[model samples]
Target: MTSTLVVIGHGMVGHRLADRLRELDTAHRWRVCVLGEEPEPAYDRVRLSAYLRNRSRAALSLVRPDFLADPRITVRSASPAVSVDRRARTVHTAGGEPITYDALVLATGSRPFVPPVPGRHLGNCFVQRTVEDIDALSAAARPGRPAVVIGGGLLGLEAAQGLQLLGMRPHLVESAPHLMPAQLDGEAARVLQDGAARLGLHLHCGTTVVSVDGGAGGLVRSVTLGDGSVVEADLVVFAAGIRPRDDLPVTPALPLAERGGYLTDAFCRTADDRIWAVGECAAVLGRCHGLVAPGYRMADSVACGLTGHHADPLDEMDDSTELKLLGVHVATFGSTSGDAGTAVEVTFQEGASRYAKVFLHRASGALLGGILAGETGSRADLAPWVGRRPTADLESVLFPAPPFRPLSP
Candidate 1:
């Protein structure tokens, strides 16, 4: 008898789980049903800013052509799971439909963390998450108008750049002393700041927004910083961070991690053997990973377990990231920082444009972690050497010789 597998949420990671299961279940032992809250199918959220340029939904879609045609897969868009009955093995949808399943997977991703501040509920304030949010922002953005983007991390920078592309003057605000504090150190952040400045992007670091003043018609007029200074703006975007979506009404109430997310074991399974959690909604082994790489790994692990394939538990997760922000290359891998007693730190700087730092084990030469800015050509080469010693010399790995150049005659 074939079993029914119900997957809640159809974001990237959720979609990936369904795809993996379809590939692994060659014997057709299970039927899959995916429930999504959004009306549109899963798209590449990491490149969401690209929508500001072309405004094409199909360009960002992750769905395969044959995916919807597969007889074994059923997809229900705009249908959010309202509650789960563990004892009955049933999932209740918002549309008053109950789905019975042999196995259930919760892939309900996350939501943007908007800070609790005065005047935050005013019009013109937005959070970048779904396609609908982007459409609203695009419709409100006007040329030469002042806009303020909260948070200087990856998402904030992307939001600021998107506003700039819409011909708005964007001012980035970050509570941290430097930009991307979670990934890049001060020096590397400085280099990235310089690059951003060259692109006409204004930045305000080391301060928090205390209040957002409203104008007529309940629209945003200006935002007050922690230092009693104010930045005039018509638009405000909060990209501070994300909180996992683990508030679904479960019959017995699923336990959450300290930081928030469905608590799961290394196998991505909850206390009940019939249910599992993946993606940002899952907190595996008391820790929640906010990146897509780890979420993909979690999805794979669960798919393998359900398909009766031997799979490794999700214990070691790779948090490495490499991307370009405002034309500046930035990459971080493994452990980027360590106290003086635990590890040795090596740094290299070339003027104000390039900075690189690597942490190595004190006793052995094994690579621990590293940060790269301005030039990240070496990221692909160094990613494989993360937890092990490099085959080549350290200098060669860090500062690879530039391509052979011929002298001008």
Candidate 2:
């Protein structure tokens, strides 16, 4: 009998996994179905902000134009998986179609996590996750319109900048005392805030949005703060955070973490050996990595394992990350949380334009984890070295000064 594989969610990792499976097994003996809830094919959700700021639709496409034409694959758009009956090996769709499968892959991914604040459901408020989200916000954003982004993290900053691109004045409202609180320290966050301001984005740290005022036709007009001050806003984009989408109504208890992610082993397999979960939905090592790289790696590992390849389990310590955000070069790897060590921590800063930090284990000279900002040259050179070498070599490499450059082009 031909094996059937059903992949839920047509996001980045899901679509890539489907493509990889078809490439590895070209015999067309096995049937594959990719179900997507969205109306269009898989697109790059990572760059959705760019779409809001006038980027062409072609730039956001993740799959090739001819992807749907593949014979071995069935692309089902506007179809959402409503339930998964693991016992029957069938998944029920929103349209009441029960698709039976030998193997099931849940790549449900995640959705924007909006807090339970008052007036959150008001019009003129958006979450920048989908192409439709960008289209709606772009149409509403006009020149001199006051825009506010709640949550001063990566997406929040990007949304603020995107609004600025549309000639709207953007203000960043963060509840934390510092910006990028998850990745940067107080001093480092200050540098990021300075850089943001240079781009005409206002930073409002340590402020909470108590409620959104939508007196004008249920469309957001302004945000009321905890301090009882009202900041006028024509539109608001909530990039506060995201939660994994795992709403399958199954009777048998599926292992799930406290954070609502599927508890999976290193190979992205669930407690049930035949079933697997990958991407943002899987919580490996008791943590859910929201980044795309880890999700891609998980997808590859599972695909390799299914095809009889010598696939290894995921490493518990995946401390390697490097990327540039909005022209700011930032990289962080290993252990930002200080460990019990005998070693040294060094930091170098060049005003608000450049910063570099390193943490080392004192006794063994192991490179724990570090952060780099503003120095594109150093990040490009050091990120790989940090991943490959132990602490001793990192110590011998000697520290270098950070390169200073203005945030603006």
Best candidate, TM-score-wise?
Answer: 1
For residue 49, give model 2's deviation from the true position in Å.
2.0
Candidate 2 weakest ten by summed lDDT: 400-409
Clashing pairs in 2: 342-362, 343-362, 365-391, 365-392, 366-391, 367-391
Clashes of each: 0, 6
Which tens-of-lDDT digit does each residue in 1-409 have in candidate 1? Answer: 8999999999999999999999999999999999999998788888889988999999999999899899999999999999999989999999999999999999999999999999989999999999899999999999999999999998899999999999999999999999998999998899999999999998999999999999999999999999899999999999999999999999998889999999999999998888999999999998888999999999999999989999898888888889989888899888876767767787777677677787877778778888888864468777788778757565556656542221111
The 10-residue segment of model 1 with minimum total lDDT is 400-409
Tens digit per residue, CA lDDT, model 2, 1-409: 5688999989998988888787777455568899999998788888886786556777888888466777768989999898888888888999999999888888999989898899899999999888888888888988987888999887787788788888999988999998778887776676677677777787788989999889678899999887777889999999998888777775475889887888888888888776888888878755787888888888888788777766778866354556555567666776676554544677666666666677767765556677766643344455555433443434223234423332311
Q: At residue 93, what lDDT does model 2 achieve?
A: 91
TM-score of each: 0.96, 0.91
- Candidate 1: residue 4 Cα off by (Å): 0.7
